[model samples]
Structures are given as C-alpha cells and as structure tokens.
Target: MSDSVFVGIDVSSQTLEVASSSELKTWQVANDAAGLDALVSRLLELGPALTVLEATGGYEFEAACALQAAGLAVAVVNPRTARDFARAMGALAKTDALDAKMLAAFARVLHQHPERERFVKPLADAELQRLQALVLRRRQLVQMITSERQRMRISHVAARPSIERVIEFLKTELGDSEADVAAHVQRHHAELAAALASVPGIGAASVAVLLAELPELGRLDRRRVAALVGVAPLNRDSGQMRGQRSIWGGRADVRRTLYMATLTAVRHNPILKTHYERLLAAGKRKKVALVACMRKLLTMLNAIAKNGSKWDPSLHNA
Candidate 1:
C-alpha cells in the first residue's frame, strides 16, 4: 500500500498541471481533448491509487470526467478543502505546479479518510451532464435578467429602453432554458422527478437542480445526504468552551436551492410546517429554526428517494 501512487491535477481553462506523490515529477498538458487523452494514457501507466483535483468552477469537470472514464479513481474536491489542507500542511505558496503537488499529498491523505468514498464516485452520465448544463444555463439567464432589471431601476429614462430590451431577451432565453430542462427531465428522469415533485414545496426548478447537481441524494443515508447539502450542523467546541454548532462545507448551489424550497415548504407542507413551528416554540431563532426545517425536509426527501415512495401525509407525518 505504501508503494501505491497518488496523483493531483490542477485544471484551468487552457492547461492542466499534473503531479505525483511517488516522485518529484510534475508535468503540464493543454486542457483540450488531446491533452486529456495524453494525461489519461500517462496515468494509466502510473496506475495511481487516487487522483485529486479542485473544482475550479466548470474547468475541472471535463478533466475529472475524462479521468474517471479512463478507469482512474478521481476525486473532484472543493477548492476550499484543498486550500485548507495545504495550509494545514504549511504549503502556503500558490502556483499551478505547487497546487498540483499539494493536491497529490492531499489525495494520499484522502484515500485513507473514513468518508473517502463520498468523494470518489462516478461522474454524471451523458444524460445527467446535459441536464446539468441546461440547469446552469437557466441560472445564468435568470441572473442576467435580474441584473438588467436592477439596471433599469437606476438608469435614466433614455437608457431604460436598452435595459428593457436586454431584459426581454434574457427572459425569452430563460423561458427556453426552462423548457429544455423540463423536457430533459421528462425524457430521462420522469419517475424520480415525479416522486420528488410530490413534496409540496419542491417545484420543477428545485427538482431539476437536485437531479442535476445532487446525483447522490437518494443513494446516501440521511446523515450523509444532509451533510452533503450543508444542512447538517457541526460542533464548534474548544478545550473548555463549548460553542455554537453551525453548518459548514457542502454543495453551495444545492443548499441555496434547498433553502428556497424549504421556505415554501414551511408555509404549505403540513409536516414541515408543523416541525418548523415546533422548533420555534422551543425557543430556536427564526433562522436556526428554518435551518432545522431544511435538514428535516432534506431527510424526508432523501427517504422518499431511497424508498421510491411519494410524499404521503399520513406516513410522513407519523
């Protein structure tokens, strides 16, 4: 096991910096089809035990997926996690080569972690990948519309026409993106989407986000799923001082969508509403209580997905 190799790849729009833990060797390749194939072939020869890369927005997705497809054990971790590991190891310098080397060390540690399997899973398939792209495009269009609307509020009367034109265009694009998302879900994940939508607060948008961004929602246990979505609270205790427990790292995009859905759930979903009110009655703050509701709602959804069941008021409430 000590003789096993570990790899790290620092991915960018133009290049990928590669490193190995077994030696002082490091290399770079273009971030294109040819580069990815060459990197895969080289790693196949090395046969690393694990490969780690930071999630640099969308840049790392292709490299990670390509490596995974080549039968490599790839872990696409959050950038914050990798940075924190580097800081802990006293590797504070930042460069593509240095980052790659740090990631190689991080990969070795992560390979032995108790929760390692959580990071080392298959990337989304082609269908889910397409759905994810559409989902992200919808988000971008919504942002553009929002920005245009805000600009309209501050723009002079003469500039209003241009802002309005941009807003209209963005809205049209948003609608088309939404339609694409719906069609993709209906074609590929109708059953799962229908089951999730059975929950009162979970609308089509939320369902699409979950199916695209959180492929592990149903496969993981309640605790794992909650933690993965950043709803699970963590202890902030010290040697003699017990501090507040707060949620930490997880999928931010998923958490945002879940939080929005939870707000609606607390208002309309009977079970969630009751649970939320109960927490408030117990003297929890509004935000705290709301977070609790998010965790509960997530766990409920997790159970529904795991059991292939729809939301049943009688059973769920019980």
Candidate 2:
C-alpha cells in the first residue's frame, strides 16, 4: 500500500472492521484493548494518511482514542454521514464490512479536502468526557422533571407521590451533575470559564454547555465557530429563484444553549441590547432580530474565547 493510504474503521461493541482504501483490504479484530493495540499497530505499519470511523454511540471511543494516541489522524464521524455517502456511491447493502469500506472511501474524500477536517477533531480527554456525561445527564433529568410535573396535573394522588419521588431523585442527581460540571471546568478550563462568565448572560449553565460540548470554541475563527454551533446561514438558490438562507446542521446542544444565553443578553447586555434594538428598528421581526442577536452574541463570545479576553462592550464588534 502507498504511504498515503486511507483507512475506514466500522466500530461496534464486539468487533472492529478495518478497511484500507489503497487495496480495499478488510479485516476484523475484537473491540478490546488488545484488538485496538493490534489495529493501531497495523495502521502505524501502513502509515495511513487519515483514518475514519463512525461514532457508534460511544462504541467507537476506545478504538479512535487508541489510534489517535498512536499519532494517527483519526476522525470519528456521524454514522448517518457515512451511510449517506454509501447510498450516494450506489452501495445499499448493510454490513459491518461494507460500512468499513464506505468509511474508508469517505476518509479518502476528507484526505483530499483538508479544509473540511475540522469536523473530525481529536477525541476529548478523560476529564472533559466525564464533564460531558454529567452535563448530558443533567439535561436528561431536566427533561424528565418537566414531564413529571406535567403528569402531576392529571395523575391520581397515589400516582403523584411515586412521580414526585422520582422527581426528587432526579433533581438531586441533577444538582450533583451540575456540581461535577462546575468542578471540572474550574479544575481544567478555569481560564476559559472565567472569560465566558464575564459575559452578562453566560451563567454556569451556559458555560457548562459550551465547555463540555464545544472544546474547539477558542481555536477556530469567528465564522467557523458560528458555523460549528450551527448559527451560520446556509444558502439555497437556483437560477433566478432565491430561497431563504438559514442555519442548520451542527451541534444542537451548543446552539440551543447559546440561544438561551442570547435571549438573556439582548435584554441586559449593553452592546447586544443596542444591536438587537437596531435590528428591530430596521423592521426585523422579533424572532429574526433575536436570532441575529444570538449570532452576534455567539461571535462576541468566540472572539473572547479566541483571544482570552474578558467581555468588553467596546470590543464586541472588534
């Protein structure tokens, strides 16, 4: 195989299917420590340019980390992206082996298009991963508590106690999760956390979401950061027919969290409030102006993150 060979790995809880784009060779190994070691050994021997794996709900975590630790360019992509690429290639058959091949092909595409490689940044370190789990579980508990509160209105007295008990447990767990998230941020990302918290609307909740989910926040440029959080508008146009350009397809959690923060900022943040009012005066709908404020607030946050500067009203646009 050539030195620039691309590899695709379809990871599962049980096995890892490794495919090589150079010769289309496929092999299987157990998805354990030894198997990952052997897989990394093989990749190091081949000196592949880039390795692609689909994120199979944390199943890909071990192998991707092992490969990345071995200094391989490992990209853990969304499974649906690989599947859609397979369909485009006229391969509708579903198999772990075929999925590996598809991922290998996609890896080759990414290898050629270096600019798009931002989607496949390296895996989070252990500390950040733990924080992410805590934040995500807290969000789940919040959802469950909302459901339980709704059910209390219609539930019988006997049923209400059981529901209330669960709600209490969930709230306790949520509090613990939030504490863990804050401790982690303070321990590892203290500077970033302080910078983000300097903004009026970004409290612990918003900072937790940004720190846990968007680790690449400070490293990317403003435009790239906006797009990463799914706030950058996308175009849909065809010959003399222009469709609305709207943001879509990125980190939903980050975007949703930022939307909440922006809602608060537009009301209280001096720079954001003025900018929001300008858009409103320019005949923008309330929701439209709000979204614009959200994007603006996001860019300002990105700038602060990028430069390690505290939030400053005079520097909002700069």
Checking candidate 1 for backbone clashes, the offending pairs are none
Tens digit of lDDT per residue, candidate 1, span 2-74? 9999999998999999999877978999999999999999999999999999888789888998988889998
TM-score of 2: 0.95
- TM-score for each model: 0.94, 0.95
lDDT of 1 at 11: 86
Query: Model 1 — which ten-residue stretch has the worst lDDT?
Result: 115-124
Where does candidate 2 stray beyond 4 Å?
A: 1-3
lDDT of each: 0.90, 0.86
lDDT, candidate 2, 1-318, per-residue tens? 345789999888999999988765699999998998899888998888889988888989988888888898889887777888899999999998898999988998877874564466458898888888988988998899999999999998989889989899989988888888888889988998999999988999899889888888878887888887888888999999999988888889988998899889988898889998999999998888887888888888788888999988877755
| Candidate 1 local distance difference test against the native | 0.90
